[model samples]
Target: MNWPVFFTRLGSAIVFAIIMMFGLLYSHPMAIIGLALLIQFLCIREFMALVAKIFPEAYFPSWLTMLTQVAGVVVLLSVPLLAIIPGFFVVSFILPVLILLVTILQKKTALTAGFTALAALLYISIPMACLITLRGGAGSFHFAIPLALILMIWMNDTMAYIVGSFIGRTPFSPISPKKTWEGTAGGALLTIAGAAVWGYFSPLQQYHMSDWMVLAFCAAVAGTAGDLLESKLKRMAGIKDSGNIMPGHGGALDRFDSLLVTLPFAFCYAAFFMVHT
Candidate 1:
């Protein structure tokens, strides 16, 4: 084990997490939306770049790519805005149509390009949008939800690696060679336990214990799947890291892969149990 590399990664993660938590919890609404938009832009950019490597000829024009990026940002911001102005929700549908129409006009890789655009919209944009929706809390801002979700993900990944490194023998999946069933199960248990402790003291306790437990389970399971999915994509793209944005952590996509899936799942779980109930 490279102690230097481990420390570098830990340091980078701590610094980055601080910035993110501050933005999510203390920043203005527009600032939070902007940060999410920035994340969406970067994730979509990384995803497209990776896909481009796999399909060389499926190249989109720079203008088209830029337009799609702008649309993706708009879609992310629109989710929360919709709560304030119901009409803003239309952008969600309009952006996809615009992407399809523009790509179809390209003539050469119309089908592939259009499909890729829509996939990015669904895969990257929507989840980011859902994140803002989670924070919005029916037009009011609540810092605890996103903060707790992120903490759980961090705890899950950290404990998974620790447990896996110490006693993991069975590989969890071929996609991510290092992951193990023992590690995964142990990590899930730790994440749930940590969340239980957090909920007991934090404002999250306002919700039922059962609700927090379900959220913990969703975050652990769906978050792990999301991590593996990104790993699969990286394997397909034949890359070690998505980008060099974070010193130790690969890229925005690499870091937030779990959150990408976890956010949407958590939102749905909360809606069904916490919000609706």
Candidate 2:
């Protein structure tokens, strides 16, 4: 085993656990927003680095880009001040367009600018907004849903690695060479088991076992898709990792890829079931 990688992963997990504790205890909207902002900024930086590698001549000032992206987040997160639905639309859709227009006028590479801005908006901000929405709502169970999603993803990833190492006969995708069909099945089974265990302990016992099972399955599938999508991007950029910020993990994007994809679905599930109930 690689000690360096092991220690790095341990440290990262500690920090994540601490932050999640804070979010759970405080239920402070701003704290969740702050964490989301930090993630968005880091993800955007990693994406910009990749874009720069692809389009060396592109002149996207990092600080300015960061500021705009963060501002957009602030605007989006303040949805209750106006109407959340419209605010979601503007921040998730319109802000990216406006940023792209500015980048185009600045004579940056259209393709790079467009992709970077759009990715920043969609990949980072949208899911984060879902988290914020979850945190703001009633019931501690809402928060548990996100936590459950994270746990399921971790379970899936761990099972996939363990199973893939031995019985992995079929590649899930060339983009993610290490992923396999056997691994995926093993991971899904493990995730379902984990979800059942979690549901047993959860304070909210209103949800049936079937509901928990479906949620776990959806989270596992979405998380895998998210991981594969990022792998594809990194492969296209000819980069080994998205960024060096996270020690064992490649970057914020690498670490939170599953969360990014799963959060939206989690939010929808919670809204439709838990919130309504």
Candidate 1 per-residue lDDT over residues 1-277, each given as its tens digit: 9999999999998988777876687657765676688788888888887777767777566666677787887778676667678887787788779888877887777567777778888888888887777776454335667777888888899999999999999999999889999999999999898877766776654576666667788889999999998898888889989988888888899989999889888887766666632
TM-score of each: 0.91, 0.85
Worst 10 residues of 2 by lDDT: 78-87
Clashing pairs in 2: none
Quote the positional error of residue 252 for candidate 2 in Å.
Answer: 0.9
lDDT tens per residue, model 2, 50-151: 766766666765554675566557544754334535555455455666777777776545556656767666667777777767766434445666666777
Q: Candidate 1, 58: how far from true, in Å?
A: 2.0
C-alpha RMSD by candidate, in order? 2.3, 2.9
Candidate that scores best on TM-score: 1
How far residue 214's Cα lies from its native spot in candidate 2, in Å, is: 2.1
